[model samples]
Target: MAYVAAAAVLLGLLVVTNLILTVGVVRRLREHTAELAALRGGGSGGLDVDVAMPAGTPVGGFDATSVADLPVSLATLGERPLVGFFSPNCQPCKEKLPSFVEYAATRPQGRDAVLAVTIGTREETAALAELLGPVATVVVESDQGPVQRAFGVSGFPAFVLVEEGVVSASGFDLAPVVDRDAVALPAAG
Candidate 1:
């Protein structure tokens, strides 16, 4: 009878703990939703996760005045520069960085294969720039700045392939492209 009472007490404690945890999770979810709404600019409470720029868009003409002393010129976007737009506060962007770094590792690193464009202060983005510095040309711009807005980027973690100053292809997520490209290459025998 004592064992049974002890078991009942333990079960009650678990239930109370679970209730507290659930309430905390619910509160976090509400806060997250509110943040999304604010970021969405009061757009019916939905988050846009898609790249706003369409394929074949001319990027050479896009003014990058907000980003001073650009490393790569808008006049020459290089043979094929994969431009990745990211934000400091984005969780997905943080998660996507490893995949992007891996993808860049497969190519010739630094000032060639890719451009890491971040929307934040230099201090805020310094770590990210260094993280990608070995594998890409890092460019910093203000949030919703000219270069970003000109590229039609509404969110972080987007990619656009630029060849001869025009966007060849673009996507919101890099995983599919990274996976596909990794598989597409012929195996060295």
Candidate 2:
């Protein structure tokens, strides 16, 4: 009977220890998740455009002057916003294109307001346009340097949302204001 009692006590201790460890693990996981969410701007209240342009980091191969010369800018696009930065040779860009297209369809003014800029030759641009179909305002620049510079794009598939000649929001997702003010339009049939 004494041995049984001792065995029960040992089992109880083991279970208690396991519970404590589980609790610790759960706490750590929660902390990690919170940190990740903060880094991703998940709980950062409203959107901020400056988040897209980290200070003191110049986007490579970009020439603001040259980009200014292009017909693609906030002023030219009118009140609608533009969202895109892509390279025809980028695999990830291709993979994300479908999602971008889907998101564009949900925009207030449809895909007309969304611009997909590709840094590639005319042929490559044509191919990318074909790939994206009628889902985006495809702009093919032989040299993405100016455009990249103008938008401060340091990487492939960078996105920016411009509102009334000013950058409103920029990040991975622009779904927040896709239906506000701008004329909403449906996806291509």
TM of each candidate vs. truth: 0.62, 0.53
Q: Which lDDT values do the candidates have, in the order given?
A: 0.69, 0.58
Candidate 1 C-alpha error for residue 83, in Å? 0.6
Per-candidate Cα RMSD to the true structure, in Å, reads 9.7, 8.9
Best model per lDDT: 1
Tens digit of lDDT per residue, candidate 1, span 51-118?
64766688735545323365455654555667788888888788788878877767542356677788
Point out the worst 10-residue segment of candidate 1 by lDDT: 180-189
lDDT of 1: 0.69
Q: Which lDDT tens digits does candidate 2 get at residues 1-189?
A: 999999999999999999999999999999887765553442344434342444233333222211223455444444555557667776656766676777766665665566677787667667777655476666667554566666676555566666544555555444443433233222221
Clashing pairs in 2: 62-149, 108-183, 108-184, 109-183
